[model samples]
Target: MTLIKKEGPSQMDVVTATASVSDQDSTKDVSPATKDSHTSPADPTEAGLRLYDHGGMVLVPTPTSDPKDPLNLAVWHKCMIIFLVGSYSAFSVLGTSGLSAVYPSLIQAYPNESPARISDLLTYPTLFMGIGNLFSMPLCVTVGRRPVFLFSLLMLIVTGFWCAFSDSLGSHVAGRSFFSMAAGQSEALAPYIVEEVHFLHERSTKLSWFIGVQTVGTAAMFVATTYIVPSMGIKWWYLIITFVNVALLLLSYLFVVETKYERVEATDGAIVHLNFAEADDSRDSESGAVRNGLRLRPDIHGPRTWQHDLRLFHFKPVWSETFTFYKDTFKSLAIPSILWLLLLNGAFLGIYVYQASTFAQVLMSPPYLFKFAYLGWVQLVQILDCVLLVPVLGYGTDLLAKVMCRWRKGVFQPEYRLISMSIPGIAAVIGCVIYGQAAAHPTQWSWMGVVAPYHLGYFAFLGANLVSITYAIDSFPRKAGPVLLVICAGRGFISFGLSYSTVPLISKTGYDGAMNIFAIISGVLAGIAVPMYFLGTRFRLWAMQRLWPKLNQ
Candidate 1:
């Protein structure tokens, strides 16, 4: 039950040595193979292979001797990889939403086109961002994280240049769609990479940081592009995006190593093995070599070095495994608890997009009369929400889980995270009510009043999103990657549809009526968490016991 460095002999040498001893000690006249078979099962400790133990705390999925194992890598190295991938994810989003500020200039350039056509520049890209996940997720799962990410970045850079120079509407839309498709990996794969490198205790906080950077990128782009478009031109704005992508691509090539590792949980359920080596009596392999698991190899030949990481370019897809992955992803939707979580995330995104699409139109008319240049400043509220509220919600939930675990005699349950959702859920309901009512009387309340609810609503909405995603991942760690793909694609598509219908819905229902309707929907969705909080553990247990087996089949 203690971690010890076995540097003198390879793992196979130890296994052979143990086999010889077991054969001599056997009561019956059994062969060496027979003795190993009997001892391996009887001992239950894998013949003294050390279990990672630190001060009575066992490392789940015990790290291998291999320095390239992400868990075994130096803490600084892990942080550097996380930072690099996170930056790539954030910049992808920045590119996706950056053009929102330049719509006016685009309209002038294509005078024959309707405003709606110009709007497609943004809408099409958003739609493709989600669609791209279908392809990106499979590629990342099969080939490798580094190669897929590099490919996506290359597409992003090329499409960015195409968008910057294209003169025709047709060409622009095409370029933007391709650009978004490439950027989609940021949403689909970034969280998966985080999970691959970090432990259970570190997941929620790390994921929060990743999600936060994405929001920052989206918000920062609006502010930067807003100024760039008015001061320079739309082309210059895209050029800036292109330049940033080039820089990120270079960083990714040099530093971002492969994170995919074959992790196996211990059968006794006491620990997890990050790199397991199955015993083979037929061959006397090297000390660190194992036939069935990731063998302990030098960092230079494994994931740690650029030369080894370049192997990601070799595309190899196991068709049956890929098919099974897709099947399981779809099957996961049948679980009600998971379905509800996805809906909650999608509802928040729908509301966010609806508000973003309408806020400019509402403020520009009548009493406030804010100019287009100033409209981009509205995102500052969202930026503040991310900065102040995200840490409180992210780390706050992690702390809550830890405290609850201590109270429960050091046993952690995924349900502990749901308790923190109540506050944000209620806040969202109130924010929606205020925003809905304020939009009805823009002139009377002034733009400030209308915007106040927005700040509150978005803050609460994002908090709920962060908590729910973390909860889902914790509840189903093995399936989290594909599940996240479903969430990302589902929410994006839903948001696109909601955004498209916003103006028509508002015109038909009037701003107050529409907002009220949306408020009711938001409240109902957020309120689902109340019952879930009280009864979620039972549901999770039920799924594990009943639903999971069925889904696997």
Candidate 2:
């Protein structure tokens, strides 16, 4: 904001500057969508005026007028899209950890392989899952959201069949790896949908749904497969999942609209000071309010039709843009805020991933000698955790962000959301400690004990992520586009790296010792948040000013 000397304007010039957007185009919406907002400023200083969105509050990723822009879509319509995406996200996790139910059978099936090696079936696929997430970004940008989603579902279907009939352990592992690769897109791509379609006011809540539904799906799959594998066998589990993919593919094709939008006019998301008047019915963010966007008038394009949604391909393939977007997807990893959030989310997810990968191995061995059929009961407890924590962690943080924003006079501070991290951060450490203690002293704690905390560890994992992701995006709304990729990809790569070590780590350190390590790490990470809450703003600002320009170009 370089200041310039200027001649004084007359009262007439002032009146002209303050005229409503309607003065220019009656047919257009109250808000003009362009790189430059033509609407009057929200605040007038002695020298000039400051502009804003959302009745003088700056809307993040400023709203646009294009009928197809997801931000401008009807509330119910956007909800339906998120609902479908959430469902897709939930089921996607089944491909990652669902096979935990059959770990014993896999051991026998792969007699020549070590138990540690067999764990590769679960561990290694996570790397491929990250790869899949990375792949989805460029495709979703270059191709279309619907095509990428439909294509990933296709991958799941094909790879699922490949896993079901695989005779050798190597083949089965490969199939699982590929199966997860397809499913992993839900982690990256779904969050992008949530970010693009929802407002800053509600973004956290939507992101929590992304986390919560997926966690529930993970637990649900474990429960179902444990029961299924015992009676119908492992192949049936694969077949059932395949059938699920087929149904999901069909549902997606019908309901998942292409979200790749090139605005007829641009509404860049940026905050600015402005003076504007609020109207009586402005509370209605939906419908014909410019707050969201004045809908296409009945005289204009009217409501979007089902025919538009059901269509698959929205754009021609642009290989050049694909490569560019592919690089852009990874660029956020360099931002200090992005890297911090990645570490935070990864730390929390690690506790859950480790628990998930190791649970069957621990319970089915000497101490309890539990049968595979009983693992479902363990997952049920995690399902309970999922149900209990979603409201507390997801919606809770969203409410906090809203309250804090109002306190700051609509100037949102992303750091305020980290207050939600306390409960989960504490829970993460406590859960690790208690779960570790139980694992070490099984004779005292018993098999009944370890699984409960082990299952519930996922609650802490997802809860922390819910806070980290929402805050990270809020901290840098301009870069929110890439937060999905960085956080999800980092989680994938981090979790994958942890896989090779989890089994051996427990073996060397003993159960309690391994958990002690995680407990300390989690506690340390949690402690870092206190400083982050204070300094995070500075770091993000510095990165945006110093680093963003270079990376973006």
Candidate 3:
């Protein structure tokens, strides 16, 4: 009756193990239909009784040893890591955009703050957020994922509280910087989740969900900022969010059991005897010793005590190893798959973050004269982005897959993901134009027309991200995280650059000029999507064959 029952591999075609692995050893073809006639209900525990498809021994959960019992599916064990990471990411995004909606009030509260000074609140956090990834990624690689996640969540909570209560500019800047440190995880954790929880087939949808949820978070903050900041007061809004963030911190600590499983590179039968307790103690001891250069003795640490960390750094081939990592990193930069991802996702990111933070400020103030709470309401536009755009694009992707599969006599092609980009690409350009034109002559259009860019633009924005991210994952199945990291890093840089300069650009050139230029860029980029759609599949194949091999050698 439980959601995740301990079903035997025979009953449900599932496999469980102490170390849930997906290597060649576990890939044996032994479905239920092929079960041997001689085999009865032998003790599955009787030294590795071949359990259905899984060649390795089944590590059954507590309560029963029956191989066919419905009590052990690893998929059902974890409560959807997608939702967990996505929810926490939502908190960080809310923190980032929340201040944008209420900047006027902040300025009024502290009248001496200049435009340059005000800009730092937005710019510095984003700047640090990008740089923070450099540290976060390495830390996750070294210290372990759970600790970083917990530490980041705590940072958000504590700093959010400080930001809420702090009055002075110095405290606000410091708090925002602390919050930025956590906010950077939004980029790093995407791959972390994608790498751990989701399978290759399901990665795109999960990544979309991650991004879509974060978008919703920003939109929700926009809604709340408009409503909460004015009614509850700016300080109270921060306090409320502080509590919410703190709750997330607790949730992470309590429920978020470590998913940072160390990847084993050894072949089957390559025994890694880890004395985890001893490994912990040895790691503690070697932490200081590795500062100079010396491996922790196995005698002192024991088998479980052997760690891959400090040894990685101390290894004589460290430079070559580092070069190899960076070489792999930069090679992805030139990859067409990566470039395509950069183009579509990067464009949307640039526009959305830029418009949401800057233009929302413009629309809500005098002439429009919308109050702070109502200003936050601008985020409602993104609701249309999510509700309307995501489903349509998602369905288009599914339909295209069916069509492509049918064309190939039921053989599916990864190119199916590209079809969804069509509507979003055009819509993005049109939306940008509309927003620019509306801003140019605000009196000419209704609020709907003025806000049309955001609502309509988000359709393409969300769709593009969905398509591109999915496509990237499909192309490089194993290296999806690294590819996504570059995509996210590029997006962050583009968005931050645009956001910092948006006010100045709009001020000097006017909204019409600024948005018109962006619109033109969108149009050109949208046009590129066509050739990309046509040749993208072939390009992926070529990349895998000629391109990747040559580079690897």
* Highest lDDT against the true fold, candidate: 2
- Order the candidates by lDDT, highest first: 2, 1, 3
TM-score of each: 0.81, 0.83, 0.71
Tens digit of per-residue lDDT, candidate 2, span 212-276: 66666766787887778767877888898889778878877876677666632322223332223
- What TM-score quantifies how close candidate 1 is to the native fold? 0.81
Off by over 4 Å in 2: 1-59, 112-116, 262-269, 272-293, 298-303, 316-318, 326-330, 361-371, 446-448, 550-553
Full ranking by TM-score = 2, 1, 3
Off by over 4 Å in 3: 1-80, 138-144, 165-167, 191-196, 231-235, 257-325, 365-367, 537-553
**What lDDT is obtained when candidate 2 is compared to the true structure?**
0.67
For candidate 3, the TM-score is 0.71
Instruction: Give candidate 3's root-mean-square deviation (CA, Å).
Output: 12.7
- Residue 20 deviation, candidate 1, in Å? 30
What overall lDDT goes with each candidate model?
0.65, 0.67, 0.57
Candidate with the larger TM-score of 2 and 3: 2
- Candidate 2 scores a C-alpha RMSD against the true structure in Å of 6.4
lDDT of 3 by residue, 1-553 (tens): 0111122322111222222222332211222222231122122211111211222212111112121111111342233455566778777877765777777677776788786787677777766676666556555544556677777887888888888888888888888888887888877654465445443234445566666677787787777776776577777877877787777766555545444432222111111111111111111232222100112223543322124321223212233433444455576787775776776676776777656665665576546756655665667667666666445665456556555544543333456677667788788788888887777777776666667777766667667767776667555544445566677666777777777777788888887888787777777776776677656655654554454554222
Question: What is the C-alpha RMSD, rounded to one decimal, of candidate 1?
Answer: 9.3
Best by TM-score: 2
Model 3 C-alpha lDDT versus the unseen true structure: 0.57
lDDT for 307 in candidate 2 is 75
